[model samples]
Target: MTFANVGTLGTKPGKRDEVVAILTRRNPQLESAGCLLYEVGTNDDEPDTVFVAELWTSAEAHQASLSLDTVREAIAEAMPLLSGQMGGDRFTVAGSPLRG
Candidate 1:
């Protein structure tokens, strides 16, 4: 089943942009690493937050992505910018932009 993992990152007062930059650069690599869809977004109402949306071919593929060198590096770089606990919701794909 397709795995949809959506998450939000709350960064330190001035660190949101940097966190987003790192994630933005890494997103394309995720697609190369078996992610069916990958996106990084921000919320205007929440300036310190970065939103992540990902679609993987399977749960294993999502797990494998965490082990990828580039992904590991990105995580390390983004970790310090995190100011609060990461929050997320997982879903099974019943409908999506990719379904067509």
Candidate 2:
């Protein structure tokens, strides 16, 4: 099944722009590493909060990408900007029993 991940990033005040820039700059490399869909945006009312949605072909693919040097570097770069915590969840796509 396809895998999906939704993450919420809580950043320090005035750090949203920097956080977004970091993620945006890494988008191409992430996409090339089997990230089918990737999105990053700020919460309307919570200016310091950023939300990211990602989709990959499979859970294994996602995990493999995480181990890539580029991804590891990006995570290290982003860690300091976070204020509260980063929350994320993984899910598997669902399909009708009869369809399969």
Candidate 3:
């Protein structure tokens, strides 16, 4: 089944843009695997938050991404810019209008 991951990456008071930049730069690497859709977003009301939405071919694919060299490198580079805790949810894809 397809897997969906959605989360917020919190940064320091003024580090959201920097974090987004890093994630943006690493977008291709993140999507180079079984990823179907990968999106990064931020809220103006929540300047310290960066949101990521990912769709993988399967849960295994998502799990395997953790071991990917590019992902590891992205994490290492983005760690210092992180201030608050990282949190996310994983879901099984049922249906979605965008998928059509």
**Which residue segments of model 2 deviate by more than 4 Å?**
95-100
Total clashing pairs in model 2? 0
Q: What is the TM-score of each candidate against the true structure?
A: 0.88, 0.84, 0.88
lDDT of each: 0.87, 0.85, 0.87
Lowest lDDT block of 10, candidate 1: 25-34
TM-score of 2: 0.84
Cα-based lDDT at residue 43, candidate 3: 96
Alpha-carbon RMSD of each model: 1.8, 3.2, 1.7
lDDT of 3 by residue, 47-68 (tens): 9899999899999988998998
TM-score of candidate 1 relative to the true fold: 0.88
Worst 10 residues of 2 by lDDT: 91-100
Estimate, for each residue in 1-100, the C-alpha lDDT of model 2 and write its tens digit.
Answer: 7789999999998898888988878456677778888899987798988899988988888999988887788789988998977798889978547557
Task: Tell me how candidate 1 scores on lDDT.
Answer: 0.87
| lDDT: the better of candidates 1 and 2 | 1
